[model samples]
Target: MFTRILPAFAAGLLAASPVAADTDIAFALDWRFEGPSAPYFLAIDNGHFEAEGLSVEITAGQGSLDAIPKVASGAFPLGFADINSLVRFLDQNPGAPVTAVMMVYDSPPFSIVGRVSQGISGIGDLEGSVLGAPPPDGAWAQFPILAEVNGIDVSTITIEPVGFPTREPMLAEGNVDAVTGFNFSSYLSLARLGVPEEDITTILFADHGVELYGNAIIVNTDFAAENPEIVTGFLTAVARGWSDAIADPLAAAAAVIERNPAGDQELEGRRLELAIEANVLTDYVRENGMGQIDADRMDRAIEQLRLTYEFTSEPDAALYFTDAYLPDAELRMIAPE
Candidate 1:
């Protein structure tokens, strides 16, 4: 009932679409198995990929930038990663074979998680406080733009280059006043570390003035060119998987736990819910279906990136994302929260 549009409009057309011979796909993820990944696991379990004539193996990654080179190198045919990072990678590499086929998170999860008790109730409050940032972190990489747009004085802030493993724990222990991370990731991780939920202040970059996007599904250009039908089918299945997750996030989280047994189910479920409500299902995506980017917004994002990263070449939005493989609107629609 939460799904606003009836999907029957394109069902017949999608059924008539040419089916690719069963293909095996190796998918590289941006981070370790977590709540956000449940949709892909659900895709495998719910027969979405099988229905698309594809068998997929999703590999965990080290960080947001981890999948870019792997997918670009053709070590993996497809990957999920940050588009901002991808822009930088492509600008630097100049003829990389990888490009984003689908936009997964309409609004990015990049955020600054701080303790309210540490006087980090808002963006300006970040001044004169310790900010723990991981060098390779996608969120931390974009902190400068978030700072520039929000008018925060970076000089007053003490930045600590922390490791990913110690990021949230250091904040929970009050070792650092705040930490840069994904909204769903750091917020829930701190709660699990026994930090009071009310004391945690999540400053999502999207909610602020930052006009950037989040992670997306990317594919090797050569692979997509050689197997166009397979690429389309894979993207369709991925969209279906996300729709299924939006329908029942708790069940989706359990699907993730099936593969990552060491993970805490309840905490992951909460994390999944956080991701769904905050990042995945944005107002723009609610009306426009998933997996497609807004050109004007993407242009704004590129301009914002210029504030922090110096592009080696002029940025091209076409080189970054192509919606050629996205499923029809009906098929891409997810249930609104």
Candidate 2:
């Protein structure tokens, strides 16, 4: 169980009447409707958004970098995306009105998954082996940074650029020794392909050396400034949704299966559990609640990015994220499952 103290103002925000004009919010997700995405759907199914005077419509995204432009272009008022990608996007397209407001994956899922039977087990095992990577994969985009920090000589590895659909299949078929992907997604994909669970080895960049934050709730800065209350209300509802998901992952995945009828309930439930254990409910997040970042860790993450990415402008953490719209502390904490 978890406990929190809520200020009067914060309590008032959460208890705001649903009679207020419902602000239509189109939320763009970073990836397809998988286990991790169930919370947002759970929010809608449970009337959490409606209580906050919000009508949110969620759409699946192609990849980690998919939703940044959508939100910045004003096509979507809000989105979930890789914060690391957002930092680079803002640097390349200066003055683009997009920034992360709530951190979802406190510990990012960027990882290199391998098969033990294929003679690949960890970061160092990739040397002299074929590594399958998708051009737009969030994990692949961060591999250079991971290699630099971990002292893994990327040049020693043969990289085979593969499509998203082919990434897991090629690795499972032993065409590639390993693949860069989310730990939860890739692990489950291999399992469903009939690979023995003991043969799978997940080398999480975060565990080895990567000090980066993962997918975050991004917003159009211009829109957020204009509709501060709406943003706050949206976050409150989201926090509640995530809280529910953490408490009952099976139910959360069931909520997702309701939307995507083809999705396997058991597989998605396991996927959601892995994400919660490895990404979302970290030691820091469990203690401090969610939707905020530690300044020191964020500073280190920025410096780590600078190793591989030459920023056109000086990197400023302020331009990338803000907790201004996060709900109250009580609303943010997800009770231990």
Q: Which one is best on TM-score?
A: 2
Model 2 lDDT on a 0 to 1 scale: 0.87
lDDT of 2 by residue, 44-135 (tens): 99999999888778888889999999888777778999999999999999999999999989999999999999998777788888899998
Residue 12 lDDT in model 1? 27
Off by over 4 Å in 2: 1-19
Model 1 alpha-carbon drift over 4 Å, by segment: 1-21
lDDT of 1 at 219: 88
| Model 2 steric clash pairs | none
Give the count of colliding residue pairs in each prediction: 0, 0
Please state every model's RMSD to the true fold in angstroms: 7.3, 6.8
